[model samples]
Target: MTKNISKEIPKEKRFLIMVILLTGVFFTLLNETLLNLAIPVLVNEMDAAPSTVQWVVTGYMLIMGVFIPVSSLMIQWFTTRQLFIGSLVLFSVGSLVSGLAAALPYLFIGRFFQAMGTALLLPLMMHTLLMLYPAKKRGTVMGFIGLVIMVAPAIGPPLSGVILDFLNWRWLFFMMLPLIFLVLISSIFVLDNVTTVTRPKIDIRSILFSIFGFGGIVFGLSFAGDESVSWLNPSVYISLCVGLVCLSGFVWRQLKSVTPMLEMRTFRHPMFSLAALLLFIGMMTQFSTIILLPFLFENALGVSTVAAGLILLPGAIINGAISPFIGRIFDKFGPKILVIPGMILLVIGLQLFIKVNTATSILMFILLYTLVMIAIAMIIMPAQTNGLNQLPAKYYSHGTAIFNTLQQIAGATGIAFYVTMMSVGQNLYPSTSGIIGGAGRYSRCRDTVCF
Candidate 1:
C-alpha cells in the first residue's frame, strides 16, 4: 500500500500539495504577528488596559505552546489531509470570530481558537514536508519553509502599519478571511493522507501535565516583564516552579509510557541535540531583535512607526528571497560550512548594535539588520533540517513537534527577558543622556544575561 501510494504521487502532485500546505501555513503565521501593531488600537477601542489587551497576543502564544506537545500524538492518530483541512477550517472560524468580535473577551476567545489551528498547522507542515522529501532534498524544501518562517513575522509589522493607515483593527482579521477560506476550500480537494494513522490510546494525565507544564512556564515568562508582576511575586515563582515540576513529570511519564506523547529519545542523537540547541539560541536572538529594534527606531531614533517598519522591510525581503539558494548550498555542501560562517555573521551583527547611539546612521542600521537576517536565513532552516535528518522516519512528527514547541518557548522567553532588561535599564538610567552614556550597556547586558 505504501509503495502504491508513493508511485501514484507524481512530482507535480507533490508540488501542488506543498503549495497548498505552504499557503495554509503562511497565512496562519502571518496572522500570528499581524495584530502586534493593533494592540494599542484595540486597547483604546475596547477600553482595556495594555496588559489586559495583550492577551490577544499572549493567549495565542500560550495556546500554541500548550498544544504543540500533543501535535506528535495528533499526527499519529489522524491522516494528513484530515489534520490539514481541520486546521484550516478552525483557523477560518477563529478569524471570523475575531473580525466580528464585539468585546475584549470575544477577541481573546477568537485568538485562542486561532492559536489552536496554528499549533496544528506549524508542525503539520514540517511533518508533511519531511514525509514528502528525502533528506538530501530537504534542505532546499525546508529553505522555502524558512522563507515563510522568516518573512511572515518580518513583514507583519509593516503590513499591519499599512493596513491600519486606512482601515481599523478588525479589518486585519476580516481581510484574512477570504484568503483562508479559499485555501481551506482548495485543500479539501487536493490534499491526501501521507502518514499512516495508528490508533494510540490518549493518555489523559500526559495531557494535563503538558497543559500546565508548558502553559505555566510560557505564561510566567510572558508576564515577567509586566510592571504589576514582580519577579518576587508568588504568582511568577509559583507558576515557574509548577511548570518545572510538571514538565519533569511529563518527561518521566513519556520515558515510561508505551507510546510517548513526544519521542524524548530523539535527543539521544548528538547531531539532533546540537541542532536543537542552535535553533533555540537562534530563535531567542531573532525574537529579541524583533522586540527591540522597533523601540530603538521609534523611541530613541525618532523614526515613525511606518518608517521603522519600512527600514526593517528590505532586509527581511532580501533574507527570504535568498533562503532557497542557501538551502541549495546546504544540500550540496552540508551544514557545517554554512552554520559556522552564519554564526560568525550573526555575532558580528549583534556586536554592531552594542555601541548604538543617537548618531548611528539609519543606513548602517539597515545594513547590519540585513546582515543579521541573512545570517539567520543561512542558519535556521539548515540546522533544523539537519537535525531532523538525524532521526529515523518514525520519529519525524515527534521531532518536529519537540523542536517547534521549544522554538515557541524560546521566543516567549526572549521577549520577556529583553523587555525586562530594557525596562530596568530605562528605570536605572531615567534620561536619554543617561541611556546614551551607557549606550553599549543594553547589548552588553543582553550578551551577559542571555548568552
Candidate 2:
C-alpha cells in the first residue's frame, strides 16, 4: 500500500496479501532442507566432490546472509508488490537454471539465484505480518505462522526422498516450477502494494564488509573438509582470514554509522545477547543434524533414499505438530520455563546423536532426531520473543533483521563445519577399518577399497 492508503487495511485484503506472502515463504523454506537426500545422488550423478556438493546448501544461505541486510533497502527502493514479484522471479529462474544444470558450477549458479529470492521473501513477509496484526495478538498470530512455516522444511526430506527414488536429482528443483508459476499468476492478479518507498540511507561499506566477511568464512569452512586439499591450503585459511577481517570491519562500521544497516546497540541488552547466542547454537544444531543424518543413513549405513527420508519424517512431524502449542505454552509461562527444559533436551539429544553408528537402529535414530527438533521448536521463537522484549520499541525493526541475518550465517557455518568433519574422519580412516560409505565416497577406483 502506498503511504496514500488508510492506516488499517481491510480484512479481506490483508488475508489475500498474507496468503500470497506465506506461499512464497513456504517455497523458500521447503528448498532449504529438500536437498539433503539429494547430495549423495548429485555426487554420483555429476561426478562432483561431496564437499563441494554441499555448496548447494551453504551457498544458498551465504547469499541469504549477504542480502538479508539489503532487504530493507529493497523495500525502500520498491513497492511491496515490486519486491514480491522480484523475489518470485528470482526463485523461478533459479529453479529453472538449477534443473537444467549439467555440472556443479551451473548448479551453484542456480542456487545463488534461488537464495537471493529467499533472502528477500523472508523480511517482506515479516513486514506484511507486522502491519496486519495488532500488538497483543501478534504473539499468537506468529505462533500459528510458525506452525505452518516449520512444517514445510520438516516435510522436505520425505518429499525429496520420494522424488529421488524415482527420478534424477534435477527433479528436486523441477518439481517447484509449477508451484512457482501458480504463485506468480495469483500474486500478480490479487496482491497489491502494502507500503511505499521510504528511501533509507545507504551504507555501501557495511554491505561490502558483510559480503566479504561472511563469504570468506563460509568459503573457508566449505573447503576445510576436502580430502584433496591440504589443511594448509590458502583456499581454506586465506579465505577465512579475509572473511574474519572483513566481518570485523563490518561490525566496526555498524557501530560507527549514524544509520547502521543493522543496529549493533540492540545487543547491549543482556537478554538479547544471551538469546542470540542460544538461537545461534540452536540453528547450528538444526542444520548440522539435517545434513548429517541423511549422510549417515544413506551413505554410511547404506539405507535407501526413500527409507532415509522416511526415517527423518517422524522427527519432522513431531517438530511441526508441537510448535504452535509451544508458542502458546510460552505465552502462558514465559521463556525461562520453556528455554531451560529445551536446553536440557537439546543437550541430551546431541549427546545421543554421538551414539549413532552404522549399527544404530532406524527407530533409535528417529527418536533422537525427534527430540532435537522438539527442543529446537521450544527454544527458537520463545527465546527470540524474550530477547526482542528486552529492546525498546525503537529497535524492534532492526532487532528482528539482525536476528535473522545471524541465523542464516549460523546455518552456513554449521553445515560447513559438519561436512568438513565428516570428510576429515573419512580421510583419516578410509583404509583402517574398511568402512563402506566413506571408503566408497572418496575411492579413486569408483568403489570402496583400502589404501
Clashing pairs in 1: none
- Candidate 1 structure quality by residue, lDDT tens digits, 187-288: 888888888798688999999999999998988887785645677778778888999999999999999998888889999999899989999888888887
Candidate 1: misplaced stretches above 4 Å? Answer: 1-8, 432-451
Which candidate number has the best TM-score? Answer: 1
Best by lDDT: 1
Off by over 4 Å in 2: 1-7, 10-16, 39-54, 102-105, 189-196, 225-231, 352-360, 389-397, 418-451
Which residue pairs in candidate 2 collide? Answer: 1-193, 1-194, 1-195
Give the range where candidate 2 is weakest over 10 consecutive residues by summed lDDT: 442-451
Query: lDDT value for candidate 2?
Result: 0.75
Q: Using Cα atoms with residue i matched to residue i, what is each candidate's TM-score against the true structure?
A: 0.95, 0.84
For model 1, give the 10-residue run with minimal summed lDDT. Answer: 442-451
The alpha-carbon deviation from the true structure for residue 227 of candidate 1, after best TM-score superposition, in angstroms, is: 5.4
